[model samples]
Target: MVASLLILAVSGGMLWAVGLNYDGLTGGQAQKVHPASYLCVLLVLWQMLRRGNPVANLVSAAEHRPASCLLAAASIAMAAQIILRGASGTAGAIDTFLQAALVMILLLESDARSLRRLETLVHAVMAANAVLGIVEFATGQRFFPFRLDGATFETDTRSAALQGHPLGNATLTACYVLALIAGGGSLKPLTRLVMIAVQLVALVTFGGRSAIVVTLVLGGAFGLAQLLRAIARGRIPLLAAAGAACALPLVATTVAGLAYGGFFDALLGRFASDGGSANARVAMFDLFSRLPLRDLILGPDPSLVDSLRRITGLEWGIENPIIRVVLYQGALMALLLTTAVTLFLVEVGRRCRAGIAMPMIAFVVLINTFESLGGKTTLLAKFVIVLVALYRPFPETRIARAS
Candidate 1:
């Protein structure tokens, strides 16, 4: 279980380092052989072969009857859709199937019962990425130390860290940071504050506007909850309250000082700019609206990009995961996907009965709007794992009984 946890953490955290894109390979081809998926498969296979008791593992997974059934149904539905529609391309189809397989294996093999172990795994991943980001910031080079020409760190303005893209690094870090905040009282105040500060700095340095927005919103929500809890507990004396109010400006000034010049302005400017990228996404939605109801329900023919290009005379892929799902996989599947995620969030809320999950869920939804997360199986797996860890048996029992 420890080995599995480490595999998930290291692979999911250092995605760019694991998944190398070689020269002469198309994007789809590179995705098909992503090192994270390959390593996961090997790990699963090694466990099965070494134990020689795949049946026992399957039975153990069945203990979580509802989750097991839901996973099985979702996997079948996804596989059937891909097999019937034949995916957008051969490489895409292969990648989808492989990723689907990996997710299934991870869900079945992972033992998330130990919340402490899981938390440690998560912190390890975050710490590794934070160190990598520091290294990349100090030296304008990739941290993986690979010799692949043209495959080195390419982004000049933003910190990619080990997650490949600036947005990917920022989004993933934001999620983990939110999770850490959600695991309230489990960490010391100073330690938690320092961890959040480190991740926030990395997020700001990455300069992903969407990620930045989501992180700030979620972090604010976490802070508000903490304040409310302190008030309810009678921990906030009048003197302390007045002191905090007086120090707010100093805190804000310190944050501003830490941010690079024009950091906040650039974030706002990205939102204000009516660049081709923004126009393309808006045009894609416009094209979606013009399509027939049948296409919306059954998905577009030829491909979303092709259909949009034909209609708007501009080539661009759907950036929103929800929109991409509805466009390519039909509204029904999209509905199912949304329902599953909603149910998971509802369950987390029911178990933990806290405000933490709410902010994290909102962050996930907001980030997915800007970038398609369908292909990011490792990230998704880590997310579900963290959610489960957050509301696992021990914490759930303690919190629920208190409530």
Candidate 2:
């Protein structure tokens, strides 16, 4: 039973990391629900039914009270909203939410040893996915059949990796890379460094300007902090630093050689010119201005929003989750979601190590800036996996409950 549980836990993490895109690979949303989604729902129920299981123990544990409660409430509210509102993308959103929620449950209930193994699985899959992203970028080939509503999802430079969407791939890769830097202790120092480099490049290839910029700001800030510590502790000598600085030309030469294939040219060009994505983000605010007071509270009709989109020339739909929540689900649901997310972070932060929790938290907050949680995205589920992988419970709290 223990062995089976371990396998289940690890497999669930792997499933989310690679996220096979089973539902939409060939064409439209062929299956209403993903196979992975069904497996996750079943896993949660199965674990709950089994006595003395981690799920059972966690429910009765003191430390898990806040997080577990929030998870339950949020899950219930999200499902109710989907059923009651029957919003445009509710079918995909609900499945993604449940899978993410249950994965958190599975992780929260596991023993520390199981978490260690799960962490390793997550790292491996993400690293492999980065490599796959590189291959797709180079070959201009999408491993999964890319079709959206019976039409080919075409792109010139960005890769459709396993995530199937360039922006989603960029966001997930950027966030996962950040999470690894935070708490992915399963990887060795060198392996971690390699992944950091590879996935950062993968971030560029995936072509999400927001993800790249956020990563740089946060990652650069973190790197600066580490550099300061090294200097203060005399771990890095002044002479050695100067020598390294002087070697910048050599480093540039090597980097240029690596970029010889021009894989990075497109992203670099995008940095120079965002093709109105920036304007769109700013212009999206105009949506709320046009909405009536009642529409702001109850959310305007989908057809109405569509007409507004056309008028606003936002043919691509709203990209910001902040605006998405209010415009799609109303302010009430938005408030509830914001409250739940805030509680989940606070509860997990105290339990997790500062290093891991801080980056993971930043990733979540920054990611929603560009990626909407209201859409057909596995982003939430993926974030939950990172949360549970690094979660560090109070041992004594669990012990007291067991006694």
Candidate 3:
């Protein structure tokens, strides 16, 4: 029952998130934001309801075990932001909320009965997301209410719709596709085919080089892993089919590359553009270096956010979440956040032992390659996944009481 509600909350929140503007408020907050985000907050709290101490519940799973220096270092950096800057409190609140949700999931899923329900929820979300994405594409308007502007889904000027941010859309679509794959839920062949078609269309819409790169990297890795497993199992035909399938895409791309100059040119242009150059990041790195040593250890004051805006003519930095946290919060706070998340991921990975964790890691690593993951929404999503993957209640315990 709790898992069902959480799924509804997540679906509702994603719809709202896609619908809302970059500011994250719908209709000035006075007109009323969608109830989805608030619902997500409630779902997160459900983890701790009369459930005994959360920390104590996780104790058997060793969640509070002593963390490594790398982990410690990261959390300290995050803590520094909260203590010194006070800038990230709102975003941090979202992260904490997601963390709570994850804890609940881990606790709830420990039993067989709850695990089945969780699987159902995952598949349902995947189906819903795929349908919404397709409908939005077909209509050429935001699929959900109060849609926001980004690279893909545009609410701004005339040409903006045509040039919708490709990468962001692709990332969102691909994440759902991966979720379906990782969740291990059963689906009919036609439904699976439909999902692939929808995701492919979304991918083309995304048009970000980073998304393309991620697709290639992750696709290659998964293919290799599967092939190795097939070989070990002596599945000769499967190995042959896998090898042939992998070669086909590259071959098709190469053939298409020769026929279209714009395709190759645009691809290369993403790399050559000065504004997108790696040297741009170097400038930010230099700024980090010039700060006082203590700034790296703790963080700048919350007022520094305004200071940073005045200097950069932008609200936030790009390309590195770590750098963003350090600049916005402080070293200590960044460190704390990093440690908590790292530990959470490690714990969940050990418990599930599923390949699902690979794509989650890829999402983070890939985003950091092009843009910072320090945004409140981005961090919140990250923490939510951690919560979902980790939390599973004791079904036996719940059932016994009911019986």
lDDT of 3 by residue, 149-252 (tens): 32332332111111122333445445545544443345565566556555544454344556556666676677588869988998768665776798689768
TM-score of each: 0.73, 0.82, 0.65
lDDT, candidate 2, equals 0.64
- Give the clashing residue pairs of candidate 2, or none: none
Error (Å) of candidate 2 at residue 204 is 1.7
Better of 2 and 3 by TM-score: 2
In candidate 3 the C-alpha lDDT for residue 351 amounts to 40
For candidate 2, give the lDDT of residue 154: 60
* RMSD value for candidate 1: 5.3
Best by TM-score: 2
Q: After superposition, which runs of candidate 1 have C-alpha atoms over 4 Å from their true positions?
A: 1-65, 89-114, 134-156, 228-234, 237-250, 259-268, 289-295, 310-316, 344-355, 389-392, 395-403
Error in Å for residue 337 of model 3: 1.6
Give the backbone clash total of model 1: 0
Per-residue lDDT of 335-388 in model 2, one digit per residue for the tens? 776776667656655555556644565557655666456555566666656555
Candidate 2, poorest ten consecutive residues by summed lDDT:
4-13
Query: Stretches of candidate 3 above 4 Å error?
Result: 1-88, 96-110, 134-139, 144-183, 188-194, 224-234, 237-280, 313-316, 370-372, 378-403
